[model samples]
Target: MIAFASFAQPPQDAIFPRHHPDVVDDMDVDLGEDDFERGYQRLTCPGEPITSSQAFMRGHGTYVDNEEVIASVAGTIERVNKLVTVRAVRSRYNPEVGDLVVGRITEVQPRRWKVDANSRQDAVLMLSSVNLPGGVQRRKLESDELQMRTFFEDGDLLVAEVQAFFADGAMSLHTRSLRYGKLRNGQLVTVPPALIRRLKSHFISLPCGVDLILGLNGYIWVSKHMSQSQQEGDAFDGEAVYSNRNDEIDGATRIAISRVSNIIRVFGAHFIPLTDTLLLEAYEWAVEQEGDVRDLLQEDVGDALVATVTAHN
Candidate 1:
């Protein structure tokens, strides 16, 4: 029988520095021989003894047995001071507060929307937490509650921030900011959540006129770029926030969006943590090769692209 471990937040100074602001780049924590001597083993298997419980506290992917901390899963071992955990090589998305996520509305309730954010449970987006048509600070009237579906109905996609967590660990989401709202003029791509690193900003715009929303939950939004004025100016249409209609997209822009999306898939398939710089390079390489956008997925071509883009990294 295999045990699936629950998610735990890494310590402030842990190698998996998801919560740290200083480490902005995608990085691999290299544990050398000297580091292993200091109790930082690279991997562990089930039932393997890790350390004495008296000397270290057992964390996720570990259990206390016979006064010793034993691995409960096969994965890389992570240590933070006296705490030890094994991060599974492949697992469901582990969410944290303040994470930017792209999610789909699964169910519309009385005053909230249930969003499937690829977590253990669906997240909640309260009616009070979203911005109404008129303005950001407007109070939610009874009429607004009645018209909640108009703002966010089932099957709609949105980009939002993880505002807080409920008593039961369900995430509370909010779209109060102008940047967070219904997603349109794009396609969604699903990848391993581990491939998305916590960066300074999840929103990325490539030179090819495509915008990306790198959801920490592994849902990626590839869409046409909207200018700053069109997105946030005084003349921006407030009612369009919930409009399901997509604007007219030209052929060139559509191809660019598809190309960017395919490149992301290639990187994800290789288990590479994506970054803005790496994506831009990949795009340039693809265009220079003059291969059809669909050709990027060809095994030989994809391998070549990945090798070229990551050669210097």
Candidate 2:
């Protein structure tokens, strides 16, 4: 195993990260001439050794020469990535032009909802950003109060993608389509937003046969099925977990639910993002304490979410 060393600026630790202040989104602070020492940025680039002068996104993995961290925020290095990548989770960097994410609702205003988009300022969800379907005219009316239509009150959990950065460092979001509606019937969890990928907007699948659509701007929708054609896809021969044990039906159901939620919770958004070994390790670790999967994704995890889900269910 290679013992990768990570060097970074002190200010790089505050962006997008839940910890630290002064680290706003998309904002990059520079490193002075003596900011870094002589020759510590080893070459993970095959031949050229690169020393980390400023580090951001400290815990999540780092992408090599990829320019993702070009705008480093600040932080202490925790785990260095393998060659092309390093762990930079605790760092706070802003949402760029095209970054996808999963977030939790922290505050809801008169006509908007504020989300903790894994950033310093909570992302905004304007009434117009939401696409309310099945309205009287087969679409949402313009006069509808966005705040009431989506009902994304405080404490709700959502999955969203980043569209563009606001001049005030705020990111915008949308959820006006079927794929991005209110979540129901399953569980919701949060992870380091940096790990979320942008493929198809979302990819969360739970044990209850639910498919998820995560918005890059911080809106998330989850349901039992993706569509009519996929309805039968969840067909289980009495055991969704595929267990062949002779345990009681209820016991088996409980086990299956736990397994399903954990798998999606930890690996839902990562598609070719994390190493297979790391994913397996994560799954194993989650299983170790897996008892009631619902317990893991309850009000304890998202208080406002439980209320929203309960109201819908």
Candidate 3:
């Protein structure tokens, strides 16, 4: 049917870098022509060996040999037949059905909220799927179109599940489940879609108590939940220490800015597996910045972060 093989191995030094300290995190680990020039090798199809790299790239699918499968990103892995899927930490892979996801609202249709669910096309959020606070059954009343639409309008972030796939390639989504809904007071960290483990929604608690939403769909959200509003974002997975907000300027605001800013650096093909402790340390650093640099958080900090983590490791 579909042509897909597992991963394969190459010579040493040819071992493709799983996560490069300089590469932005959201990158695909493909054996491009340039990759060959860089001496990068295809390690495995889901961790399988490849005797011939060129032939394998000619559409010959490969799978991991035996059962030794290490995650490319630090996410959960799902063994679907001969193909093992990778889901990055904090995000889930968007499968046909029963997949939990954390998505950002990229656009708003008349009655649907267009969500970027870490895929090529944006998933639709129909008016009927949301669960209002009253439990009165959300019915998208007449006034809702004019008023509430702005509330969940474009740019609103949500955590949902793939309710069903439409015949037209688009997928229907629902947030009625408790574990599925809006994500609040959390930092959205985007990594290469491959880093995540597949098939399950795991809430990983970092060594520093940071809550990580590992979606099988390839989107991860990491943040500290200790604070009533927002916790002290640190640089490591060390213990939580209190500090003076006044001395640090816009404490929580800067942290929010920094956390969201870090997303761009990691949401690509070139990414690494971040440990729970490392994630916590980064969070702490974001919360304690000051001055005009407050807005500097939006920049892609992935390169620098990668370098720092690499040096430490």
Candidate 4:
């Protein structure tokens, strides 16, 4: 009774273990040989240790704890030089300067309009940043302020660029260029911001007479393709840039737009990053299947579409 039984304590390593030794310190972890050959990105979850903090700098979606860089979100791990960051699997748009975005006007202010660009806060599009109806180089005047709605009213959709940022981190948008202006004759498709890949041109024309504006903000514009002349602002009056009327789209073009839009939705559901090449291939594959446009949304069809498109890649 006087002698008490003593219990051995667990080893220090067992009490507070580090990440698995197999987890590489670099951006990529070696999955098995097969996966490694595929060049699969390293995926991480919250609280998972990425690497020793002393060996690397932490970036967004990651935090340092106990001298180790840990993922603060579930995403793909990326490394740039000595900095490590996790790109979230799904998240709202994070605006950057010079990015092309599709947004809806939420509120019209005195000299600026608040745009919902799928960001943390509404983006601002100033009156001075837009091309006047009369001329691109025309200076902003008092009349433009009173007729702001004529340019962009509440809930009107537009395509613009990220010009700058405010002290509060809100984005400032500009539609000064001919390519950027009111969106018309199109339907909008929304997907996870992470799925839209950056390319030389976000505007894509499919072979099926469909045009796509793959906004970096995750708002896509799918519409009937316009000819080179129509796309160039010089072909018509500058007022055409802000025209709200839809150009009479034919039945065939409407069907094409619907098919492409559905294909994109399917891909988004499967969490596939979209590219122009992939969209073209997927469109062809969908047509070859001879299924109705709505059929693409069927789980089985969607899976097959994704599988087929990915196999080619």
CA lDDT of 92 in candidate 4?
91
**Steric overlap count per candidate:** 0, 50, 62, 0
Model 4 scores a C-alpha lDDT of: 0.86
> By TM-score, how accurate is candidate 1?
0.86
TM-score head-to-head 1 vs 3, winner: 1
- How do the residues 193-217 of candidate 4 rate in per-residue lDDT, one tens digit apiece? 9888888999888889998999999
- Positional deviation of residue 93's Cα in model 4 after best superposition, in angstroms: 1.2
Candidate-wise lDDT, in order: 0.86, 0.45, 0.52, 0.86
Better of 1 and 3 by lDDT: 1
Best by TM-score: 1
Off by over 4 Å in 3: 1-94, 207-209, 226-270, 274-313
Worst 10 residues of 1 by lDDT: 3-12
Q: Estimate each model's TM-score.
A: 0.86, 0.47, 0.50, 0.83
**How many clashing residue pairs are found in candidate 2?**
50
Between candidates 2 and 3, the lDDT winner: 3
Q: Cα deviation in Å at residue 152, candidate 1?
A: 1.1
188-305: candidate 2 lDDT, tens digit per residue:
5443444444564256554344455444433344334444333223222222112222223344444554454444453433221322233334444445655455543442332332
**Residue 202, model 4, lDDT:** 90
